[model samples]
Target chain A: MDSTYINEIRRQFPILNQQVYGKPLVYLDNAATTQKPLCVIDRERDYYLHENCNIHRGVHYLSQMATEAYENARRTVAAFIHAAAPHDIVFTRGTTESLNLLASSLGQLLIEENDKVLISAMEHHSNLVPWQQMLRQKKGQLLVCPMDDNGVLDLQRYETLLDEKPRIVSIAHISNTLGTINPIKEMIGMAHKHGIPVIVDGAQSIAHHYIDVQSLDCDFFVFSGHKMYAPMGIGGLYGKSDWLEKMPPYQFGGEMVDQVSFEATTFNKLPFKFEAGTPNVGAALGLESAVRFIESLDRNQIEAYESALLQRAVEQLSEIEGLRFIGQAAKRSGLVSFVIDGIHPYDLGTIIDKMGVAVRTGHHCAEPVMTRFGIPGTVRASFALYNTMEEVDVFVKAVKKAAAMLR
Target chain B: MTIKEIQDAIVEDFSMFDDWMDRYAMLIEIGKECPLIDDKYRDDKHLINGCQSRVWLSAEMKDGKVYFAADSDAVITKGIIYLLIKVFSGQTPSDILDSDLGFLDKIGLKEHLSPTRSNGLLSMLKQMMLYAEAFKLQEDKK
Candidate 1:
């Protein structure tokens, strides 16, 4: 909310204070992965330097400290997303691994022959493929809820699909490619009407807006830390206590097992049961630092700034000749995707990179969305809290110039 | 002229442009002049598979010399293909096979091209070299 505070936040990210290709770096690829602040990086490094020990096992001082730090990171994640209890949070590799864990465990527990799992067409492949594999394994049906022309998921059709008695309704909280803020709360409510549990893929949404799992009442919420300025290879999945109690453990290993006999073994309780083996302890601390970083700023202020930036970018880019936006959803967050006439997205991406404005140009792991639009890919410029209007101007100019050259 | 001489000349031509924008313009101009592939050969069988853009390439071997004709949906990729064909066409299969084609890096084209386009360029080179290799094998049999 305070311009001075926002500027101070920008100064904390050291990577932003550099040049690429002889131009000041205008990084617009935050949707793929956000750059870490020095605090987060230093926190991880500090953990390795001082608190480097395996957690929840040894009675030694360092082990207890490490165990406390790791569990505290889980609590941090739980608090960030407004989960009711910290025990509901299970740490995994990232959004992809978290989703895989959910699909594997939940599929085994819930899915049966002829049972249907419904997902939106706008889903990132991570959300879609696991369900497809689950359906294939269980001999169940995988149903798609189609998105409208503006890339909004059709809620009417989704409601109708619920009549088919889908076992689960999994969808993205915000589409990574289109930046569409899906009406997930409403969708979850509708799915609950049919007693079908909903899994929210919050990988893209978690960085941009607040998430309250208790209010959404979704069965499971999954997201990656890297997408939100934390270290890679660490993420969290929050499952309701009832589901956590019922579903089986995703992996069997040292920490997750209560007692391992030659014949059988009983798993540990809520979180540790899901997080098997030696977890990425340092990265977990880094995620805790990232959570702290997000808390240090005003969430409403950050959201408003990013939303205004996206709006200004869309307006400025609309002035360029023959530029067509892919997603015109009424509610969008943090990004924009577009294709220009006669200029390949890849070509534009290359030139933009040369101009030192980094943007992602490809299917963005959402090939179904691209196929729906009948294009190879798109040039996506995703913003973070650190981005400025000056940088947006440079990006628009660079895109326009690139389009002209390609033409 | 020799293939190396032709490549060197093209690289020198690119050196005149200090700015990336001008270099890209030159490439686009070269793409405009690239020899069009035969419509019959524009089908999937003759199309280069790995390009981000749709690039159709066809080759003919007559009297042990390789001739390439290609077209691309994207101008920049078309220009890249033009450079390859300029160096490789009207040469013996052996001459085509032995050439290193470092001219791309010399002209700063490799760094300028996106990863996908660079892969496309490599695929185009592989396809041309493959044709040359095929022609060489046929000559051996004869």
Candidate 2:
């Protein structure tokens, strides 16, 4: 891609053309949540301004149009993830809710006393806590597959942990704090061999690269739209037909009911069975727009550009004295997390913010990952497609100054 | 000077620094000047939770005035607590209770503190007020 293409992409995101603390903003907090582009924002606004209505129930024109747009958004997500059918997709509040729905429903379906649920140590709290609570309720064991010193999942230990025959295996596609991209294909295959289903938390991975649920062959996959430049409060969960067929509906309400009688109520079909009550129609349209935006940009080019940006960030940030990166995984994604000696991540983060560089401090919602590494937290700089090398230079200079001040 | 006068003085001092870096350096110096908490009072009972960094606060009443001592693991948090102690310590319980603490906003200190750190600052302030309220109750009983 040329500078013109990159600049055009940057122009679409209006939030980037601003200042913070009297300095030009260099937003490197994409891993937390991405800023929306004009198209996604406008699409959501258009839904409210022109097409606003409760979906799936009304007889009026606005309702029909909204239902079509809402269902079409499901199809867009289904196509984006290459699911077998739009019926395989379920609308969710976000990745956290999706994981909770799965854990609760799947736990009820699969987990019994003494059954095990295996998760890696690198998972965010969203992916970890539900299983822990579910297993505790079921009197089942929640086994943690340890990660190596460098933040790579210890496959040897995972293989051993699988010997216990966990009811299901859940893992992250990418570590939010460490940026370790797990070998999902091989891990899924390994779990499948043991007759266990796997759920891949793609909250971090979905924004960075292509994901095909059918290709990955995992029983389920979950992601948040806000992490990918869509509006917040919209996400999707893609479950294989077999799992969705077997599992009970996560929530019971209107539209998820096939027939409501005074005596007994039968539930609705596949995707609707999970989504309860009135959905986020505007957010769904925004998510569809975000998906269209990604499709407009070549996935291969986005991946390559992000990889190069990460390289530049790593190279530049490594030059700072006493700065040590948390995760030194061989394969990583579009983020770099580090801690400087004699400076708290909070202090470093505060100083950097004053210079108008937006980075995430603290545990990044993966307190377990920090516990595994025996550190309080790390300062993370996550890059998105709009990020330029010039912004990285500003971040590096600001970080160097921050380190000097704190130390 | 009164507690409000001291806070006004601190706010005026912070106003001299146009940049955050200079303000932070001055704040760190204020933290360095904070009197250390006694080892006996450094136990978990006196320790304030909810702080991203560990903080221990000790309060004592002598001649109807409340004296406070504090320590923190983080420099910035320590500095914030030190600033808080400067305004609250050596004041009567009633005087401490009536304090508005608007100087924090005037200096932009509250906004400058990160979310977690600001929560910690609030936790510290609450503990101080609780101490003041408790001393006030003791005096009432007497």
Candidate 3:
């Protein structure tokens, strides 16, 4: 991508034009959460200013408008991921909540004593803890798919683990800490051969690449919108209708129930049965606007631009003495995690922040990955569509300066 | 010296630095010189849990005054802990408990004290106070 196009894209995010600690802010924390664009902000504000009312069962015009907007957001999410039906998309607070919902609902439906759930070593805690808790409750076992030192998942070992006949396979589409892009399409195929279901944690991958649930043929996929320039507290889960129909409701409340009698209550249909509350109508609208913003751009160009940013970071940062990258996967996303010989990640991060660079430091909620690598933590710099090559240069300079000070 | 006198001296020392680089450089020097906790107490038992870095703190009562030894994986955090120890060590439990840590802000290192920073300075200070309170309770029992 050209500089002019990149600059135009940067202009849409109003937060980018600011200074931090007497320096222009260089935000490389997109893996944590992305800065919102003006359109997404406006869409959310417009909902509250114009159509602020309860969704679903309401007779008033404002209520109907709000309900239409919320449902439309659901449909937009469905189309974004290429789900078979709008009902397959369930609105969630974010990826963590979506995974927890699956763990709870699916555990009740599918998990039995001695059953197994397989997950990759590179999964973030959101994907790891939920399944561990679920399996513990069901008296089932949790099998881990190992990764090599380069952070690539071992396909041979993963294939071998599949012979254990795990009830489900939960894996990250892209690792938040390592940035390894797991071959979930092939992993799903292998799991399906053994009649095992798979859940793809697309929290990191959804913003970086296009997703087609039908093509992947995975049982379920989950992602958060905030990482893609939407407001927080809004995300989605796309599950196959066959599985969703059989699963129980995740929460019990007003919207999820059809009829609440003295003795028992009948739950609502596919998406509603999972929602269970008044819902975040404004954030849902913001998420839809973010999806539209991404669709408006040339996705292929954006992907290529981000990959270049990651490459630039790797090449430049590798020149620094004593700095070692943690994850060097053959197939990776637009992030890099590394540690210096003697300097701790927290110390480096603190100094880097003084230079107006925002990067994530520490285990990134992937303590298992840290243990696997035999390190305390790593400093991760993640790139996004709006991140510029110039910003990457600034980040590299900041890291170099911080390393000098620490050394 | 009393805790107040020591904190005042630290504030005066830090006042010489005009920018963050000098301030952090001094902190890094202090970290290098900071007394480390014995390896025996450096396990999970003495570990301060909240900070992004691993911090080990141990305290003992000598002649009715508390002395502390602490260590951290991060140099900046260790330096901050050294500062905390300088202020509170060799002080009576009551004096340590009664002391205020507003000197952290006066030294322009207030950001480290923020809970969001996750550097464990705040947790370290709290742990020190708890150690003093425990010693006081034991004295009361005696």
Choose the strongest candidate by DockQ.
3
Scored by TM against the true chain B, the candidates give 0.90, 0.90, 0.94
| DockQ comparison, 1 vs 2, better candidate | 1
Alpha carbon lDDT of residue A71, candidate 2?
A: 94
Question: Model 1 off-target regions past 4 Å?
Answer: A1-3, B33-35, B46-54, B112-119
Which has the better TM-score: candidate 1, or candidate 2? Answer: 2
Query: Which lDDT value does model 3 have at A58?
Result: 98
lDDT of 3 by residue, A289-373 (tens): 9999999999999999999999999999999999899989989997999999999999999999999999999999999999999
List candidate 3 stretches off by more than 4 Å. none
lDDT of 3 at A108: 91
* lDDT: worst 10-residue window of model 1 chain B: B111-120
Q: Write the per-residue lDDT of candidate 2 for residues A275-346, one digit (tens) a residue.
A: 889999999999999999999997899899999889998999888888899999999998999988877787
TM-score of each candidate structure, all chains considered together: 0.95, 0.97, 0.99
In angstroms, how far off is A223's CA in candidate 1? 0.5
lDDT per residue as tens, model 1, A1-407: 55677678889999999999789999999999999999999999999899999999999999999999998988888998899899999989999998999889999999999999999999999999999998998899999999988999999999899999999889999999999999999999999998999999999999889999999999999999999999999998999999998999988897899998899999898878998899999999999999999998888989999998899999999999899999999999999999998788877887788899999987898988999999988999999999988899999999988887777
Residue A207, model 3, lDDT: 91
| lDDT of every predicted structure (CA atoms) | 0.89, 0.90, 0.93
In model 1, how large is the Cα lDDT of residue A267? 89
Q: After superposition, how far is residue B31 of candidate 3 from its true place, in Å?
A: 0.5
RMSD of 3: 1.0
